[model samples]
Target: IFTSTDQVVQVNGSAATGDMDVLANHTPSIEHIRPGVVEVILEYKSSLALGSGGCTNAHPVSNQHINIVEAAPPESFSPKAVSAKLHGALKVATGNGSEEEKIGSRKV
Candidate 1:
């Protein structure tokens, strides 16, 4: 268990998956076992596909963007101190072009 002076924590993107735990510098209680620590399990909808679409003699049909975020109590040691990280992949499909070409041409 860790503690922090801040009151909030945030996690973003695909990196927030499965079981996760955080520790902050705050008082611990029965409910807040790990006063500064927070735990979360992030998930994405497998059914939802993100990307673009195209077909034979077809043009750009669609585009999509998906984002996820998680927040927790901040640490007590340094209220101003904050740490964050993000992970995810952008998927795009162009029927006429290869996957590599489609991804390489686009700006991430």
Candidate 2:
């Protein structure tokens, strides 16, 4: 089990055999990111957020292939992504954002 600080909990790629769990201090490796549903499970004591994506920071030696992967925190994920697998809603607003930017809650 991983805690809140455990960033980049999972990476799902198109060629990946299956979903894999990621934890802190993980061994360095790589996976072929596929265009599939990437679920990022973040544990908030009071809130169980089922979501997508990755953290900005990766271990200098960690196996990270970001280009082929779509990573974002739950708060920024569109209602579709949240509702698709996890039955929940995350409401956010992007003051000056494009459609996708709004989905990711990018402030611009």
Most TM-score-accurate candidate: 2
- For residues 1-108, could you state the per-residue lDDT of candidate 2 as single tens digits? 233345554543234545665544456655444444444433333222332333323355763434422344446568886475343223334244456646665544
Off by over 4 Å in 1: 1-6, 9-17, 25-108
Candidate 1 on 1-108: residue-level lDDT in tens? 122332323221222232222222223311112112233222321121221221111113211112222233333334333221111222234244567757665758
Report clashes for each candidate as comma-separated counts: 21, 6
Question: Would you give me the overall lDDT of model 2?
Answer: 0.44
TM-score of each predicted structure versus truth:
0.14, 0.33
Each model's C-alpha lDDT? 0.26, 0.44
The C-alpha local distance difference test score for the whole of candidate 1 amounts to: 0.26
